[model samples]
Target: MTDAAPSPDIAVLLADDHDLMRESFRALLDASPGFRTAGEAGTGAEAIRLAREYRPDVVLMDVRMPEMDGIEATRRICADPDLSGVQVLILTTFDLDEYVYAALTAGASGFLVKDSTATELLNGIRLVAAGEALLAPRVTRRLIATFTGKGQPAGSPRGLDEITEREQEVLVLIASGLSNTEIAQELNVALGTVKTHIGRLLNKLDARDRAQLVIAAYDSGLVTPRSR
Candidate 1:
């Protein structure tokens, strides 16, 4: 009998201005299981071109680039209808670059510090490829610290008025860094119920992942850093 087919490797594109960083990441991904390096790019413009060419599962984007910045590249990639399946993960020098928050706003799935352990980077790629957001508590905290009190009016995403009150509560809890299980326990609802609410929130807000939902909650003034 024929053997069952093997799972396909998660294709990744490494985008950094430095050749050393790209080579290092490619080595790590090559040595790991369930991963394959699709290609590499030294500029944001090149990253965009390679993204169209390779259509990788994830793009590890460095924020600072020579021509265009990583944030702009991320915005273009995310905005492309043909590249909907691609997710960008920002890499920076700090735990969170001050601009990392902006990268998230530009449609990156999440981020990793340049010094992250190999395990962390690999897991982040897997999570993003599997359509799960890579937002950890620390990432969420960074986002909150940067954009929570600019006095941006609520309902910035254009459909906030349509969400039910319960959905709003769930969004607030999400921005506060509560996991699905935690939200379920806090609301005394079944976990499935929480998932359903989040699904609806995603649809109404036109957000691709929970990271964007967190941004929406803050932009809408539904949950503020001071409040959390």
Candidate 2:
């Protein structure tokens, strides 16, 4: 006897004004299993409406658009209590520190450049859908440096002193842009063990996401840039 077919995957909403870009993204998402387009919107207002109506598991938001930009739409979507679980991932051409800071502050789970590969885009959607923050380590570092004035780290150095030795070690690696798989290999620990450490670090630092954690790492001097 034949086996039962798998259930359809979580729905996704693609929001962007550009027709060609939207079509391209839709095709890419369609090629991936476990995901289907709930709908598409060309404006921020429409994006917000569809999100509330369809309640997609994830949203692909472009940073720049006419009428209402992606940033405002993200903020509105996240603010709605009913759409709490809907994850927003920003896809744009610029990874400017300003956008990085705003997106993270607005509760975006991930940020990516438009030039990223289809594989990267698919992975980012999955990661955010799984409730993980998707931020490139280098971008995170730059955001932290800018927020803290780069010339000097913020907060009392002692603020992070409370973190255990192991936790600090993990933060350094995280700020350095290593994913769980990479960190596990580098530290000789299991993947599950690395996740546990990261969870602990997030709590100890009172961080909202990995992007914020990277900021804390720099502010606390746990990670520093090389001299000019």
Candidate 3:
């Protein structure tokens, strides 16, 4: 008889200081299908070591940890050429914590509050593992507000000049918190066309995902909080 196809598994590395929290997360992730616990770390240093060794598909990183903290660890992981495929998902207890935006700037794919429902957490991991940014429109607004509130200098738009004018419009809409479907409807274009524009924007801007694209838009001054 022919052999059945192997099930796809998403390797995950759990990084948190609390034993109970780590254990709970491990139990939930292990019990879920398509997810396997590749390793666990009680500190940021350990997380970095285990990540280098396992090169997991997703790292559930806690923002606060001994020795390194999730932000620094995420920066290091993203800086590594060998770990390019790895995606870091930040975990925090507060939704409006200042560190959330910093973690994103440090190259995190997204953030999740500890109190999120089991379904939200699992779907978040799945989304990040699939190379998607998990920011919703409300979250995007909060991030933009945070940036402007801090009076952070706008980012340079040096790289953005490479894209076509239509792609520039799409980037601005993305930064304005519009999803592909929303952008398609607003621009009166096909959904496939919107996706194509976003894909090209990612390539031209050298952004990893939509979250980075949003950051780029703000940094480039293409979309400003004042304009929203």
Candidate 4:
């Protein structure tokens, strides 16, 4: 009989100040299939050290930590050319708007509230490890509000002068929180076509993922938040 192929294991590093929380996360991840604990750190500095040592695929980073905070750690990890493949997923109990924006700006692949279900957490890790941005709906709304609260008018943003009009339309739809499938449906095109446009958008804007593209869209005044 032929043997089945082995599932890919995702290495995760847990960085939290609380001992219990770290233990819980380790247990949860270890119990789940296709995931393994790389190591655990009790402080941001230690997290950075272990990241350099283990080069984990994803870091479950707590927002608040001793020695350094997760934001700074994320920034350092992302800035390091050696750790470019390592993605940081910010885990925090607080849903403060500042933390959300700061984490993303510092290059976090995603953010999750501590109260998230085990399934949600696991899915988030997987999404981020696969080079996708995992922005929660609530978090998305907050991000839009934080920027558009300034009451600035929408205008053309830089880096968009190179893309075609169709690409621009796709980007605006992306900033509006539409998935590729939804975009394809909305544009009356094939899903593959939508993905092609997204790829072109990413290349033209020099964005790492959809979340960064959303930020750029807002920053460039290509999209604005609807007034409540």
Candidate 5:
């Protein structure tokens, strides 16, 4: 019997103050197909250095690190004009309302409760790497509600004017939690085309990742999450 060849290599950096958690995530990510643990850090400062030196494709960060904290580190990481392609995924034990919104706005590609299974973890990393926002439909709606103040109109109505019409359409669906494949089918365009549009949208919007895009979509008033 032949074994499946590993997936293409994905460079990963782990940042967590908790040694156990760091080791655990490192093992899970290493076990996943096509993933490599480039480095691990116990604080936000270390995370920043490893991120700059290793330049991993994805960084699994913890929000409560000492010194800089994950949110600040995330902001710095995403702020780097050179490392625009690197994605940061926040992993935390607590899904506190405050932290969730802050992390996403701070340029995290997504936030995952620490209880997530290995499969979910790997999938989240892959999705973020593929330039997709990791927020679930429900989570996205909650974020919109929290930041937009429930129908009070998002930031300047013209904030989204920078995005092209096609890019706007893609942003709307993305904020709605539709995957690229789903968006392609809904828009009747090729999947690769959808990806290209998303990439351009991110650059045009000055968003670091899909999660930030979701925040921008809501903040820019491009799309409103319906109220129940």
Candidate 6:
């Protein structure tokens, strides 16, 4: 008996204004296993349209698309109830772009530096696709540091009323870029307890993932960027 053909499960949409950039990403995905390119979009408008058409597992969105910016695209994608399963991973030249906070606010799951190594990029894609956790700790720290003002994180942190004191503490550490293990050590609790707090935070805050948890913490003003 002949076996059926295999299909890559993680469908990815590449959205970038640059042809070369899209081609590069396509090549990388082509070479990697368990991934396949669903489609390509050279503009934010196109990205949104294709997102609805393809409903890929993840969209590698460039922030500076021609007709529409990725932030706007991300906002639309995230807001659309039909595209709930799709995750947007912002693509930018700098790891700590001024748009990182905006992208997160607009509903991006994580950031992907264009010049990142293949391993890092692939891992980021997989992580976002899984919706398991925040993409990167170092990048998360940089984002918080860049956006969160000294003494107080930017924006109005909301939904504090819904969670307990310990959950609130976990949010602060998450915003501060502490891993679950690190948070466990700092709080002198088991790692599973830290995970439980995060789970509660995610549920109470209506956040999509750890990335959104950081956003919520900043909005709530629970954590502030450390001074240099």
Per-model lDDT: 0.89, 0.79, 0.86, 0.85, 0.80, 0.84
Please give, for residues 1-228, the per-residue lDDT of candidate 4 as tens digits: 989999679999999999999999999998999999999999989999999999999999998889998989998998899999999998875556577667787888878889999999999999999998887767676667764436454454456899899998998888777778878998999999998998888888888788778877876777778622
What's the number of clashes in each of the models? 1, 0, 1, 0, 0, 3
lDDT per residue for candidate 6 within 33-141, as digits (tens), equals 8989999999999999999999999999989879899999999999999999999998786644778678888889888777799998888889888886544677777
Count steric clashes of candidate 6.
3
Distance from true location, Cα of 90 in model 4, Å = 1.4
Residue-wise C-alpha lDDT for candidate 5, range 1-228, written one tens digit per residue: 999986668888999999998888888877777888999998899999999999999999888988888988988998897778789988865446567677787788787778888888898888887766687665566556665545454574333677778888898888877778989999999999999998887777767677777777776666775623
In candidate 1, what residue range of length 10 has the lowest lDDT sum?
A: 146-155
| Rank order (by lDDT, best first) | 1, 3, 4, 6, 5, 2
TM-score, structure 3 vs. true: 0.91
CA lDDT, candidate 2, residue 84: 87
The candidate, 2 or 3, that scores higher on TM-score is: 3
Q: Candidate 5, which segments miss by more than 4 Å at Cα?
A: 1-8, 150-154, 157-159, 162-169, 184-200
What's each prediction's TM-score?
0.92, 0.80, 0.91, 0.89, 0.78, 0.88
Query: Can you give the lDDT of residue 197 in candidate 6?
Result: 92
- lDDT, candidate 3, 1-228, per-residue tens: 999998688999999999999899999999999999989998888988999999999999998888988888999998889999999998886554578788887899988888989999999999999999878687667768766435655666556878999998898888888888999999999999999998988888889888788878877667787765
Worst 10 residues of 6 by lDDT: 150-159
Stretches of model 2 off by over 4 angstroms after superposition: 1-7, 95-97, 138-162, 218-228
lDDT of 1 by residue, 143-193 (tens): 687656676565578778899999999998888878899999999999999
The candidate, 1 or 4, that scores higher on TM-score is 1
Give me the runs in candidate 1 sitting further than 4 Å from their true place: 1-4
Candidate 2 or 4, higher lDDT? 4
